[model samples]
Target: MSRIGVVTFPGSLDDRDALRAIRLSGAEPVALWHDDADLHGVDAVVLPGGFSYGDYLRCGAIARFSPAMLSIVDAANAGLPVLGICNGFQILCEAHLLPGALTRNEHLHFRNRDQWLRVEQTDTAWTSAYQPGEEILIPVKNGEGCYVADPATLEMLETTGRVVFRYLRGNPNGSQHDIAGVRNAAGNVVGLMPHPEHAVEALTGPSTDGLGIFTAVLAHLGTAVPAASRDRR
Candidate 1:
């Protein structure tokens, strides 16, 4: 079975949830530590949400320099599938694994709600289980969840189809272009402000829609798409 690693930083609150979601998706859940450089030979990695490092120097700023992240940066660059949720999204940006920055919400309040998201891109490793334009409900809770980028970078993301999930009913945190999630140029790395792991089970979450995000990776691993076959941008 494929092993998916969930990295737990000092303040990570959702690592267990992500591990459970991965196990439910029929993949082995591997617990990874923020201070460990080894990935444990996992096929994929997930950075769960929380105020890493007590949100001391910004949500994910401190955690971005952790030992594990140093190794993750190299693996991610080599096309390893990596998913980041909520504060994890902030870390991805801080690590330069994904473009743009996550800033405070326009309302300057912690927004928590079951958000509707449209799957804008399905070719990505983390989104292939979703159909283009398909809508899903997932929970979003954050203070610094607003995604921002320069005009040229935003245009590049839109034009190259890197925007993955977009807010549907309403813009939760004033993310640009209603972008809730995005993938790296090679489509192996994805970062989003919503907690898909929280939505994998209908009993606890808004819907089971989030299961697709985890299942999609399992499927992608099964296919073993070559790095040369992936889109360059």
Candidate 2:
């Protein structure tokens, strides 16, 4: 089985949820400690959302120097599939794995709600299961969810199709161009400000659309179940 590593930082609140979501997607979920320097031979990794290191000194500033992030940074740069959610997304930017930075929401409040997202690009390892132009519903909660980038970088991303997800309906955080997620140049590393793991089950979420992301990565790694076994909603 393709084992996916989920890093748990000191103040992480959604690591367990990510683990469960990975298991539900038919992959083995490995728990990785933030203080550990090893990756445990996992095929891919997930930087789950949370208030890492109590979100002090900026949301992900403190957590970026954790030991686990060292290996993650190295692996992600080498083309390993890496998904960063919410605060994790912030850390990715802080660590320079992705472009842009997440700042305080335009409203200056911690917004928590089911957010609608449009799949702007599906060429990434994490978004391959979704068709281009598909819409999904996922939960988003954060005080700093607004994404900002320099004009040059923003234009490059736009020209390269690196924008993976975009907010639908009304903009939730006043992110530039409604960008909800973005990917590295290689398209294996992705960072987003929404909680996809939280929306994998209909009973606890508004929809199971987020499951596509997990399954997409598995498929990209050649470990996903046969097409016949895939539950196409």
Candidate 3:
């Protein structure tokens, strides 16, 4: 089975939830601490959302130097699948693995709600279960969820189809081009500003829109895709 590593930083909020999601998706969830120097040979890594270092020094800035991140960077560069959600996205940008930055919401308030998103592109390891143009709703919560970048980077993302998920109905955080997620050039690393871990089960309502992401990883591990969303395109 694919052992997915969920990295836990000092103030991580969703490590458990991420682990549970991995298990529900039929993969073994491995606990990885920020201070650890090893990845335990996990198949994939998930940087769960949270206010690491209490969001001090600007979101993921302080957490960037955490020991675990060093190995993560090396592993990611070697083509290990890595998914960074919300604050995790911030860390990925600070780590220079992904382009662009996540800034404070235009509203200047922490937004928490179920959001509609379109699978703009799905060629990456984390989003392969989704098809082009598939629309889904997952919960988004963060004060710094606004995605931004220089014109050149934005242009590159637009032209190369690296923008993976996009806000559908409303641009809650006023992100550039309504981008909810993006992938690295090789498509092995993905970072997004929403919490897919919160929408995996039916009890969470708003549909099981986020399960495809977890299942996508599971499918890569030799598991079959769930029938409920088989044709999610």
Candidate 4:
């Protein structure tokens, strides 16, 4: 089976949820520690959401320097798939894995809601299962969910088709251009402010839309190599 790792930082609250989602997606969920430099030979990595390091210094500023993140930086540069959700998204930005910064919401309140997102780019490794322009409902909860970037960076993201997910209906956090998620230039790394792991099961989530994210990665791995040889990588 394909092994996908979920990194648990000191304050990570959704690592288990991500693991469950991965298992439900037909992949083995490998538990990874924030302080461990080794990836445990997992095919991909997920940085689950929470106020890492007590949200001290900055939301993800401290966690970005964790030993695990350092190794992830190298693996991601070598084309390993990585996903970051909510607070995980902040860590990706702080680690320079993705562009832009997530700032406080315009309303300055902790907003939690079932958010509707449009899949603007599906060519990415973590989004291939989704169709272009497909809409999915995922839960979003955060204080610093507003995404910001300079004009050039914003233009670059928009022009290159790197903006992966966009908020529909009303803007939840006043994010620039309604951008809820973005991917790196190589399309192997993605960071979003929504908690997709929370929306994987219909019994609890708004819809089963979030399962697509996990399944997409599995499919990517399947095509990348045969199942028996997958873990060897």
Candidate 5:
């Protein structure tokens, strides 16, 4: 089975949820420490969300220098699949792996609620199972969820089709263009604000729309191409 590494920082609250999601998607979940400095031969990594380093200075600024992050950055650049959720998204920005920084909610308060997201682009390692324009509902919670980037970066992101997810109903946290998620230029690294792990089971009461992310990651690792018959290659 593909081994998925979930990084546990000092304040990560969603590490276990990420592990369960990986298992549900038929992958072996590996718990990696924040200071390990190694990926433990895992096929992929998931930076689960929470108040890393107590969200000091900035959401992920302090955690960016964690020893384990160095390994993750190297592997991610070499095409290892990486997914950053919420504060993980912030870390991606802080580490310069992906563009944009998450800022305080426009409402100026920590907000938590089920969010509606539109799949803006599906040609990514973590969203291949979704069709362009697919809409999903996942829970989002955070104080700084708004995504901001310079004009040039924003234009480049838009032109490259790197924007993966967007807010649908409410622009919860005021993410730019209602942007809920984005990917690196190479598509190997992705970051999103919503917590997909929290929505994987229907017993929790909401639709299981978030499961597509984990399924999509598995699809990325597998040799199977999505909609294989539609491929002309």
Candidate 6:
């Protein structure tokens, strides 16, 4: 089975949920510590949401220098699939793996609710299971979820289809361009302000639509490598 690694920093609150979501998607979940530099050969990695390092000095600024992130940054740059949710999104920005920064919500409040998102780009590794324009409901909770980029970078994202997900019904946290998520130029690294892992099970969450991300990564990896190589991983 494909092994997906979930990194746990000092204050990560959703690592277990991400692990469960990975298992539900028919993949193995590997627990990777924030202080570990090794990736354990996992096929993909997920930086789950939480108040990492107590959210001091900014949501993810402190956690950006975690040992695990060093490997994650290198792996993601080499085309390994990486997904960042909420605070993880903040971390990705701080690490410079993706463009823009997730600032405090426009309303200056910690917004937490079931959020509706539109799949704007299905070409990314984390969004391939979704159809273009498809809508999904997932939970979002954060104080800094507003995504902002310079004009040039925003235009690049719009033109290159790097904007993977957008807020649908209402703009929660006032993200620019209503962007809920975005992917790297290579489409292997994606960061979102919503908590998809929290919505993977209908019994526990608002919906199961979030399962698409985990499944999409598996599909992306399957097609990217030779069948034999995939089997070995």
- Number of the top TM-score candidate: 2
List ranges where model 3 is wrong by over 4 Å: 223-233
- In candidate 6, which residue ranges exceed 4 Å CA deviation? 223-233
Instruction: Give me candidate 3's TM-score against the actual structure.
Output: 0.95
Cα lDDT tens digits for candidate 4, 138-220: 99999999999999999999999999999999899999999999999999999999988998776889987888888889888
Q: How close is every model to the real structure, measured as TM-score?
A: 0.95, 0.97, 0.95, 0.95, 0.94, 0.94
Per-model C-alpha lDDT, please?
Answer: 0.91, 0.92, 0.89, 0.92, 0.87, 0.89
Q: After superposition, which runs of candidate 4 have C-alpha atoms over 4 Å from their true positions?
A: 223-233
lDDT of 5 by residue, 1-233 (tens): 67889999999999999999777666789999999998899988999999999999999998889999988999999999999999999999999999989999988988889988999989888988778998888899988999998889889998889999998888988888888999998898999999988887778726677777877877789833334222211
How big is the positional error of residue 233 in model 2, measured in Å on the Cα after superposition?
Answer: 2.4
TM-score of structure candidate 6: 0.94
* Backbone clash numbers for all candidates listed: 0, 0, 0, 0, 0, 0
- lDDT tens digits, residues 38-113, model 3? 9999999999999999999888998889999999999999999999999999999999999999999999999999
Q: Each prediction's Cα RMSD?
A: 5.2, 1.2, 1.8, 4.2, 3.9, 4.2
Candidate 4 residue 198 Cα shift, in angstroms, is: 0.7
Misplaced by over 4 Å in model 5 are 223-233
For residues 90-191, what per-residue lDDT tens digits would candidate 1 score against the true structure? 999999999999999989999999999999999998999888999889999999999999999999999999999999888988999999999999999999
Off by over 4 Å in 2: 226-229
